[model samples]
Target: MSLDLGRTASPGSTPRAPGRLGVPVTAAEALRYLTDLGLWIDARRSQLSAIDQAALNAPDQGDREALTHDLTVSMALWKAIADRYELLKVAFDSGRVGPTQAEQISTLIWGRLDVTPGQAGEAARSRVPSTADGALAVSLPEACRLSDAMTSSLRARLALEPTAMDVGLRVKSIREGIERIRDQIGLIPPGASRDKANHDLVGLEQRLFGVTERAKRGADVGGYLGPLEVDVAGRERDLIVAAARRVSGERDAATARAKVADLAARGDAIRSLQAQCLRDVTPAPKLGVPDVRALGAVPTDADAVDAFLRRLELVSRALDQAHETYARALAEREELRGLLGALDAQAATSPAITEDERADLAPLHTQLVATLASTPVPLVRARALMAAYQSYLQAVTTNVRGPR
Candidate 1:
């Protein structure tokens, strides 16, 4: 159930002002406050009764005694408050007191409800207004605040009891949320990402079944309330919230599709680039591209899809580096070829062809021939050959004419 977060009390209603020794001074102030208290208790009597019985059957003597004492005193207070309301009604009907005055008189009993010693007594003393003005001083809104606190306390106590509250409604809420998320994602086709997401969905469904089963088993079936039971409920609640957030109509689905499509296109672009490099570049280098065939699957879970997108991003970077390396190697081969061609042309035009000159050019020519014959010529060796060719051209020029 959703907790109300608005308007705890009626607006502009005055609470009792503190009086001497923190006790209610006027009967009217006490009556109003006690009336609020009585009504709150009436509303939660069934839950409180269940808790009372559970406490009585509790194994821990300390828990049994404490809960019993608190329940007894609270009931007594409620009854006393009820009795005062009746008396005030009678007085007002008989013309013995005005409606306002009679109302205030009933709240006087708030501080007088007998309580046993110890924690329950201390709680009662602190919670029950004592000052004459404070006794009946709470406005309707303040009373609401008090009622809410009481309801919460009762629920907490009930959670510890074997009379396990019907969790069906909560379970229903979670199921509904999950169904909405499922429907939203159903628009997508089957794929690896979707398959992974479906796997997680299956797990959630199993957990839901487990939660439902345990809830069916009475709290007494287990010795007492344990953290595991609470955790199950808590986890289900979290799932409900998560599913609720994930549920979106066509607009959201469109937006999500747009995002996925953008990422997928980028991934495809990298793959295409790698493929082209492999075909066009001599002695193709490995791009280490991930097998993304699974990405074609439609994703059901947002988280799973997000993770897949991240993997695509990493793969893109790797492909980018590999593509760059391939281009650089290809460029270096072209530049080395241009330099060797220039040297060969210069040698053919040399005015003097000495024996030493021919000898010098012969090995250079062999090295260039060997390099051209090989696929994916070694970059370092090609650069060295280009440098040696340049030096040879310079020597030929110096011998033919003179150093410039």
Candidate 2:
């Protein structure tokens, strides 16, 4: 297990508070700052719990007693800070605090708080003692500083000369890391890279063996063990990264190949559509359907494969645009055919047209039909002719109706 002592005080010393706590300009500001302090206190309480548990499990009697004493003092200091903080928080939360209330809150934050029973007033008058039994008066920040000092000291002692269990756990972890790295090394291809990585792993393994032996002999192997663990972990990371890159490169190459095949199919379909549009529709767009084969085979190198994929994407987009243009042109031609048919049918059944007028319009309609039905129909000319025919028919209808 790992302990994260967040924002710890500097090693071997209690943090000193400022000459005086600065009063917050507003109650809300005070509340915000206090809220943050409350979170820090909560974190410290958790750390103290872990430390207490570790102390209870301490193998040596002397170490256990010393840790117990430290834990007691730290807990007491924490309680002092926590108690004062809760009170100040309630005052601030009441929403009635002004400049005077702000000053009082500042005092509680920075001034020594008396935690001694039955001596609160006397403790305020006399110079406060730091002993565990006497009038223990410590400000919120001061209590934190003192608690941090003790926590740091205990943590340092444990780290410098960890118990047999700690040593065993550490050794087991390092061994596991070495094994993982060795497995990762097998993934590297047979080349200078693999050989060099294998050589580095051998050296780390030797160092780990030596450290394990020192730990067996009950020596302080922390110095050797810590660095060896770091080295092994770093090598593991490097090998994992290399393996990831190789896998990624393989996957990218496969994707690039798949994209190429798909684009080829699309290009073929687009070409067929283009042919049809050119044969049947006048003024068809002449955009070229890109030949994906021109991009060549996907390269083995990662960067080259990436560039290849980018080009494939461009080709795919161009194919899409070309396909859309041709299909739209063909659709428009069909639409014009439908419109012409509908108009001719309307004119034939229209009561406004006399038999003599129908005879006169019949040849014009036939000529329009022939032009529209011809291969490579001219869209511009078709539109103009349709418009003129519709206008002439409308004019005859209007004349028949006579001033509607």
Candidate 3:
């Protein structure tokens, strides 16, 4: 929405009076279209997911090729929808604006169609999400808002230029360094080896730097990968790296809490064993020992209740200490729950896993589900938490993409 002061139209360009959307070609209208696309893509994804689940869960006797083909077609449609958004997202990021809303629309449309032949070929291979029932939907009602936005962008006639990739590469390289730093933070006697991690990190950074440099120079760039690379390195002073750190911290916290809980349970079992040992070692109370309550029956006024008071003080203190430990254990469990939320929030900022990448995480996600299902929490809440976390990351990543 920030107006570019440098926009200039060539000679003989017709200046436009504001159109129906209040700007030239309605960018707001364009955005609305994108929103619509998101809705359909999401719905399609959900439908696809259900199909995958059903197929995988059933006896292994389905038409695999046929199913794959059907899903492939669905993926194509989804790519078309996503491409529409990616184009707008790029232009907006590059600060390209036209003199009127119509021009803005024209630029966006042209940009989509203007890909280098090689880029187009690569795009053709990018799969779409497979689905049709619309179980997963993109938020659509708000998509119609592009009309004004396109118009406003056109009014500015902002300049369009290819991004300089060196900066991005340099920034990405630093992230590798930061990752090593993060590993160092935990690599102590009680932790992992930071030096070994750092050694591996150097190689990792070098590879990342080399690849990024190539991408900057127009090598190995293709489809959604280009935009995704931009997202990792193009944002503010590499806040993306900061985000990754948050994710790591969340993961560590969650793991630590889990470990603590396991240790505490073990300690409780051992403590119980120790208590039994003490009982056995006491040799059943000797006949000379006070008969706890029977001492009250003594006829000589020997302050019976006083004898009981001293023993009660010791028992009460011991119970109080145990209660404190139990309370701490409970609090730690709650903290772990909160850490899951934090981790989810951080993961949400991660670039979305494509259908292909989703396959990789499928195992981990499935494991998470099975583990969560066995917990006291309801399946609904566990499932909801993961979905919500995914949605949150998608939104945050989208925002980082910026509007032209």
Q: Write candidate 1's Cα lDDT for 246-289 as tens digits.
A: 43222234454665566556557766766655554456666565
After superposing candidate 2 on the true structure, give the runs of residues whose Cα lies further than 4 Å from its correct spot. 1-168, 189-193, 209-221, 241-255, 299-310, 355-367, 394-400
Q: What order do candidates take by TM-score, descending?
A: 2, 1, 3
lDDT of 3 by residue, 1-404 (tens): 43332333222111121233224445554544444444544544454555545444444354444344433433443454456556555544433445554565544443222111122222222221111211211111111111111111211121111245354543443464345344433533332444554554565456556766766787854333343333322221122222323333444345444544544454455456444333332221121111123223312111232333444444445544554554444343354456565755555456643455456445545555553534343434454656655564455445644343
Per-prediction TM-score:
0.33, 0.52, 0.21
Candidate that beats the other on lDDT, 2 or 3, i.e. the better one: 2
lDDT of 3: 0.38
Best by TM-score: 2
Cα deviation at 169, candidate 3, in Å, is: 51
- Give me the candidate number with maximum lDDT: 2
Listing every candidate in turn, what is its Cα RMSD in Å to the true structure after a full C-alpha superposition? 22.1, 22.3, 32.8
Better of 1 and 2 by lDDT: 2
